[model samples]
Target: MPTDQIDIERYHQLALQKQKEHRLFLATLKRKAPKNLDKIVQEVHTEVFSEIDCTKCANCCRTLGPLFTEADITRIAKHFRMKLPVFEEAFLKTDEDGDKIFQSMPCPFLGEDNLCSIYDVRPKACREFPHTDRKKIYQINNLTLKNTLFCPAAYLFVEKLRERV
Candidate 1:
């Protein structure tokens, strides 16, 4: 879908309105999801993402901070030719969960064109963002619910999965 076709404000409002319903649905799904649930979700994820250009809707990069593992920190720091401590001091902060995350919204690596400057070396969490296509779809229902608020592709994946299963 075109970026213009995606009304992000409308999605946010709709997601809020349906939050309870979606939560209950996910809880129920977690308890009794279909055996093919992962396959179905993967199909939906592929279909939704194929149509939606993420570069046009970098809301994830703009609004969400991905957790950076030690390996991720090391790799990214190496990419910048900076020491780990310097990189951490410059761009990272410890979140409530003790996970290291970017210090601010709109990730520093995000370019003006809405692409990741370090796409190849981006953190594992970032690389697995929205995570709609992961195996055992029911295991990450909570994450998926949160993602719907930020990722149009994730929202569409859930909607499509509802229709499918």
Candidate 2:
């Protein structure tokens, strides 16, 4: 199992690099200025994802809660071979807005290596981790900022984008 602690110097360096990249991306977006931002964001997401690897930074699993949908519950429940009710009682609960989420911080499924224990059958939200590719990308400004600590890639993406703008 890999340790969760990232080298402070290396982590900071990478974070700064990512920030720079985000600025560049934003600058390009402003210059080219896509017809529809939603589609453009997805395209940029695909391109950025091709360049940046998430496995190298599993901060999402370490921080933040994934808003679980009903399907997330049923599939994850099946992954454990337990009824949805049993799984919910064991590892999940409804938050203030009726969204099902993990009981506490640091996902329970996160293994020592920063890999999800049930990666293949993980929740829909987990499958869509680092959801920069989605249409409502701008709406998740809060999430993108929060991901800075957990995902160096996100920091780089945003930083580079800002530069482009």
Candidate 3:
């Protein structure tokens, strides 16, 4: 990988590729979710994190637009004391067909070091990011494909999890 040209745009592309691999792995998990997602998530995270440095690959926060729910939108809007419509117009957009997503990939709120500008009040999806680390994540099996390739942490996490079962 070329590290020199990693502006937001390049990071965005790298994020897409990571998401792709995650999706591929998720398909295999559909057949079985190993019985213990928490421990599995932890073990895999241990392995994955050893290989990841969010500072270096902020691709997840930078590229993926979280699928914030109605409640999520309201909470975020209230956090900023901005009306929902205003917040939506300024930062969010309905993804291609309809689902709500951020207007830009490599979120505008990303800082010089790729930190989230709204960390404390980030959307629900943002808080549980890489949902692979979430407890009983198997409950979200319905959403695996979309989320699988959505972040590098998720991609590597899923790979390690799959290896266990």
Candidate 4:
């Protein structure tokens, strides 16, 4: 791994240590996020990402599955030149919550080097994973909090936010 790359093991360990603080921080964020929170977060997102490369650490793709929407199914199916049902049968299964997800972890579309096989037509959820730079930064505090456990960028974003806010 690169020196600047986040080690998933260390990230999780630190995340556990900071869990309570993170929860309290998020609660405080929900109560009153600064007006420029989104812009500041976007800047942090960009800065942190400069040193963090997703290709080196696809923990999100290797761990949590993306929610596949109907459009995602259609687009991916079309990209594969297969019938939708055929694609679904081959690559998808509904989770306990009835949400369509990839049938396996280390997502089938993930290449050996962590590149996405179907990058262009990947699900909307995949496109938005981590979501640190999204608008209305305060609105997604809960989701952001959850992501910190699995996404290094989110972890870094929240850590950086702590200093700025």
Candidate 5:
């Protein structure tokens, strides 16, 4: 299916309803997931991403900005020619976990076309959004489950993965 034509809100609702089932399914995979699952998932991810242009659906950047690591902070600050403290004061804030995140949603770095203004130096978390191809997929099963709601590709990936496993 073409991701641009996907009904995001409908999928979000469906994903919410399937959360428990998905979790249990992931747990089952924790023990039984193929040793080559990462390679398989990578292939799926490539195919899915080819069909889905992220620039058309920046839901992840629009809804949940990435958590910034210290390195991300330094790189971004330098990109803007600002000091870390200055950058933080202007655009970042601490989350409940004390991790640095954007001060606002629809991230400040996100352009009108859903492209990242700082794409080259984006946070590691942003680079790895909807981490479907991460090795030892079980390690990030919970995160992947959460991603399914906002990311059409993730939702489809999980559905496809179910069939594969």
Candidate 6:
């Protein structure tokens, strides 16, 4: 769907309205996930992404900060020719789980065009945003549920998954 066609407010309302049902569905799937769950998720992910252009939305970047691993810090620091400590001090903060995350929302690297200025060196978590195609998807039911609030693609993936499996 085109950027203009994505109604984020409507998505949020639907996701919230269906949150309890989605949670129950995810719990059931976790207990008896299909043997081909990964394949099914991958197929749905492909179909959803083909239709939703992320650059047009960028809601994940705008509303959520990606967890930055040590390797992610090293790579990004090197990309900026800065020391890891300096980079961390400037852009990161430790979350309650002690994971490093960007200090602000609408990520500093997010350009006015809704593109990532550091796309080539974005964090591992950023690279895997939404993570709809990951293996053993039932393992991250909670994460997927949260993502439905932030990503139209993630929301659509779940909607389609419900229809398929």
Instruction: Write candidate 5's Cα lDDT for 2-79 as tens digits.
Output: 555557788799899889988998898897888788888888888788877777778898898888999999999999
Query: Which window of ten consecutive residues has the lowest lDDT sum in model 1?
Result: 1-10
Q: Work out the TM-score per prediction.
A: 0.93, 0.70, 0.67, 0.94, 0.92, 0.94
Is candidate 2 or 5 superior in TM-score? 5
Better of 3 and 5 by TM-score: 5
- 38-156 per-residue lDDT for model 6 (tens digits): 89999999999999989878888889889898999999999999999999999999999999998888799999888999999999898998999999988999999999988888889
Cα-based lDDT for every prediction: 0.87, 0.68, 0.69, 0.88, 0.87, 0.90
Tens-place lDDT per residue, model 4, 1-165, is: 667556998887777788789889978887988988788888998988996899878999999999999999999999989999999999999999999998989899899878999999999999988888898777887898888888888888889989999
> Of models 1 and 4, which has the larger lDDT?
4
Clashes of each: 1, 18, 2, 0, 0, 1
Off by over 4 Å in 6: 1-5
Clashing pairs in 3: 19-149, 62-106
Best candidate (score: lDDT): 6
TM-score attained by model 6: 0.94
> Which digits, one per residue and each the tens of the lDDT, describe model 1 over residues 84-106?
99999999999898989999988
* Candidate 4 ranges beyond 4 A from true positions: 1-5
How do the residues 82-112 of candidate 3 rate in per-residue lDDT, one tens digit apiece? 9999999998889777888988788777897
- Cα distance off (Å), candidate 5, residue 97: 1.7
Worst 10 residues of 4 by lDDT: 1-10
TM-score of 4: 0.94
Candidate 6: C-alpha RMSD to true structure equals 1.8
What is the per-residue lDDT of model 2 for residues 54-90, given as tens digits with 9 covering 90 to 100?
6556667766778888888888888889998899999
Candidate 4: give the clashing pairs. Answer: none
